[model samples]
Target chain A: GAGVSQTPSNKVTEKGKYVELRCDPISGHTALYWYRQSLGQGPEFLIYFQGTGAADDSGLPNDRFFAVRPEGSVSTLKIQRTERGDSAVYLCASSLIGTSGQETQYFGPGTRLLVL
Target chain B: AQSVTQLDSQVPVFEEAPVELRCNYSSSVSVYLFWYVQYPNQGLQLLLKYLSGSTLVKSINGFEAEFNKSQTSFHLRKPSVHISDTAEYFCAVKSRVGGKLQFGAGTQVVVTP
Candidate 1:
């Protein structure tokens, strides 16, 4: 009955530092996704995982941005050399099955990352 | 590739008044349409979606969205709104089955008494 949850509701870090954002999907969910939302902009896709393997990761901005989902239940988004441009709200979502695009994605409260 | 555009950035309406939020999408392939709502300090919630069959879809609440293929638009409307309806609404599209979503800039609805 629990929904997707993210850790560290807010994070503040300096440029060139590293940060990790965690996401715990709903129980029994087989698919997970990450997105980023900048001020005055809509959420942009980042990465997706189907089970323990990443099904789609084309949305990842660069090699500095990586994500891992071990055991197919929890996911972590890691950012290396954080930049002010990476400052945004990191969102996580999950669905029962990702085979159909019709599945509704349940979102988390998101983690607000600020780079100073 | 797919793209979505929300016509208005903000809409202010009086309580119990009609309200409409316009959304348009562009894609080379057929896509699934969806509307998501986000209340302050809350996560994004699904309002409604248009996958197939019916061109129109309604949410549990008093919200409805009509999908138009010709116009490539999925506009959400509500005949009457409550102050509780104040929130941000987003229009999104998925070009492929189980693929990533393309979201439009959200529309902030401010309901006033």
Candidate 2:
């Protein structure tokens, strides 16, 4: 793809439900990231992947939030036992791996999740 | 650990007026700084970055930012802003090696006619 792509631009789920959000990074980009943005706030890092492995997951918030990139190209973010507080936009970004400086991160349109 | 702070949550300015958005960060190691803009219903777009060299950096869109190492600040400024420039701006920082970004809360700029 020419740019990072996220599926299901919006999602609405009831409390305690499970939801999955998908992201497809640009081709040949080995670094992928996930972020969550609440109303009136900046995007908060959730996870980062280098190739098929998770380089960092410390920012996942809790056990209910999980993400995986099995092939290093497509990633999925799963939230279990969703709470109303989980309502936010989930963003995905990709960058070329091993870029010494702060490489530009190409972001997707983002998935707006509304936990009712 | 790294964190970014955007002092203003919202800023209002008339079209063609000068505007400045303040950002600061705290980090133990040397860091790279960036500013991103998000228009309505659009993904984030990079505005400018400060990796090394001169303290000042300019974007193609008439926006500029100065990185002050002593104060740990990277403030964005525009001499003349357009109504089309109204959007949400975010300040982010990351370790030179680690690609993960830590972002400020964000500042919403509203350009009134």
User: Each model's fnat?
Assistant: 0.78, 0.82
Regions of model 1 farther than 4 Å from truth: none
Per-candidate DockQ values are 0.77, 0.82
Please write out the lDDT profile of model 2 over residues A82-114, one tens digit for every residue: 999999999999998876855789899999999
Clashing pairs in 1: none
RMSD of 2: 1.0
Candidate 1 per-residue lDDT, tens place, A22-91, comes to: 9999999898999999998899999989899998998999999999998899999999999999999999
TM-score of each candidate? Answer: 0.98, 0.97
Top candidate, metric lDDT: 2
What residue runs in model 2 are displaced by over 4 Å at the alpha carbon? none
Candidate 2, B1-113: lDDT as tens digits: 99999999999999999999999999999999999999988999889999999999999999999999999999999999999999999999989878789999999999999
In order, the first chain's TM-score in every candidate is 0.97, 0.96
